[model samples]
Target: MVRFLWVCIVVAFCFSKWVDGFVQYSQRGDPKTEIINNTLMVSITLIRGAEAKGAVCLDGTLPAYYFNRGHGSGANSWVVHFQGGGWCSNITECVARTKTQFGSSRYMLPETGFTGILSFKAEENPDFFNWNRVLIPSCDGASYSGDSENKEAQLHFRGQRMWLTFMEELMSLGMRHAKRALISGCSAGGLTSILHCDKFRGLFKKSTKVKCLSDAGFFPDEVDISGEPTFRNFFSGVVSLQGVKKNLPRFCTRHLDPTSCFFPQNLISGIKTPLFILNSAYDIYQFYAILVPASTDPNGLWDNCKLNLTNCSPSQLQIMKGYRNQMLNLLKPISKSKQNGMSVTSCYAHCQAQYQVMWHADNSTLIGTKTISQSVGDWYFDRAEIKVYDEGCHYLVPQ
Candidate 1:
């Protein structure tokens, strides 16, 4: 059944602009009603603080977010999600991103219907339907970590300041009194969640229940098919360019290079806060963007396979299988954390928690009888014990 759905998804990937649509830029694209329900008025809050002095987007626009106040019993509870867009490692890439939604508030949508964990409907988001939800927009072109300002490039790489100011603003808005809090993100945003989990917990009282979730964010620091140090080189540039070494967790930086610290595999074991990692063994973005980037495949050996998985040769699939094994192996030690939770399944999709269809459906992405929504909800609410680490072939589900 999963295989059949995978075939359909591969067809869609081949026929449609799947890569463009799923890129972090769309801010978690889910099916939207043509008119965009007028009742859902999401006002944008611009940045403000001493740290935000030069904390602007790549396009020189102020960062913003959508805040939905909770009602009834959920007023004291909070759920904050950091938006995800791929990072820019160089001045050239950041300049290009400035023209797009990832780096410019001018391109962000004024009105967006919340779905997945942000869904107002109780059926779609049972645990957090009424929680005070905050969506932190991604426009820094970094994973919300950087403090350098480039006057010549006309860019303010102050993602760290932006994150600090954003959190401070949330605390001023009554989040300091939160009884239960969850910080989550997808893709680049997911990395942000992992990076700031302990800092977020520190903001609240010890009695407060604070946790984090990273969706499709466990990027492995491994070599691409071409055996080149693609991500290392890219991250090395980003770290040096953005002055990110000082911003990283000191414990990690003390042991490893700043670029290596960015990888979850190197940083996960040191995290003291409770965390939940939701990732696909065969993450679509990593496969194309990192594993076999255009630079690694100048001849386009993976062009057909990337667009349509069904077209992949046996050797290509073998490499992908190896990638899956690496993910599982990296996760082995983190699995022992009693406070941590995970759902590392064999799927080709990215950002599972953002879409309504993938979060929970009749044929939703799952490990055994548990769907992503069910497992995450249980972990968050402490309703049930969750230890899901499925050892099987990757599965695909059509949206």
Candidate 2:
């Protein structure tokens, strides 16, 4: 217990205006041939975020190994995979740069990550099934970077800015490939799903592409973005940023703003975008940590209840709401509901030799064919281990 509390304290203390981390993955950014028998994957490096500095984080392309099993003139529905990082974070950058900075040290994505969502366990999911992953690049805090009192200012700004650019860039790429595409992210990235819904629609429609699938990025609704101290200013230091609020739209978020502001209503309402929200029974990290309930934009849910129901069947809405409710209650005062990392470690080896649980799933994308204006929303948690039961190889995904 002391150890667990210690880790939490460290995380909370580091909660500064904007704590940054970086990773550079060199996998091909392209899925493999065997996996190609499943789906086509294409990586649309958005080319935005932290660009104010003018220097591209890294020029080299990372390889993505996908498995495809669909038919198309290379024009199939695509899924844009985003990894988990609760915004204001650098987990992705850290992962991508593991080899460069750490060098084959104990930093590469361990085989365990592939074996299960949790680094060392396999109970939440039996077959670690996540595809189309991105080493979530660095985020931008825009101009709201001053007030140290309110940490969200920075987190919200960074998420809004980074996600908007991601959507636009993804839309531009989907324009020439699949019928539609999927947009997904975990933690803050999932939050990105709801916030950027509006902007994504306009761009996709303009290109005549498809809609988005927002996984568990939903937080009741946003109230007001304006807070006591804005995080934009604090973020300026990280991106070689310049100017003030006046520089916005024209210079700043022009490439960073999520569709939330311009659209008002969560984008889910405006367009008939299909979204698949998945969350864990113990996803308190997002619920308790990120959700500033009173502050979430109210109009955010404006689009959800009306106008967009034709496609969002009752079943879909029910499923989404159910998980969201579970999310709400569990996160009210969010604490690590999942088993503690320490508990997972063997206590100097149990008296008897006990087998540990390992859950995993594999996914692949094939961009072998090309279509235009498409997307797939398949964002989900890396895996939130609610309770570390010794369950083995069970299919958690619905069949």
Q: Model 2 misses residue 103 by how many Å?
A: 19
Q: Taking the tens digit of each residue's C-alpha lDDT, what string does model 1 give over 1-399? A: 999999999898876765543321122322222224422335566665433376677777878887777766887999999888988889999888889879888888775667788776677778887788888878986688888878998887888888887887789888999999999999999999998999999999999999999998899988988898788788788888887888888889998988998888988899999899998887888887778988888888888887767788999999998988888889876688888888987777888887776787566656778878899999888887676866553344322
TM-score of 1: 0.87
Clashes of each: 0, 96
The whole-model C-alpha lDDT of candidate 2 against the native structure comes to 0.30
RMSD of each: 12.0, 20.0
Report lDDT (CA) for all predictions: 0.80, 0.30
Q: Which whole-number lDDT from 0 to 100 does residue 156 have in model 1?
A: 77
The residue ranges of model 1 lying beyond 4 angstroms of the native Cα positions read 1-41, 48-52, 391-399
- Using TM-score as the measure, the top candidate is 1
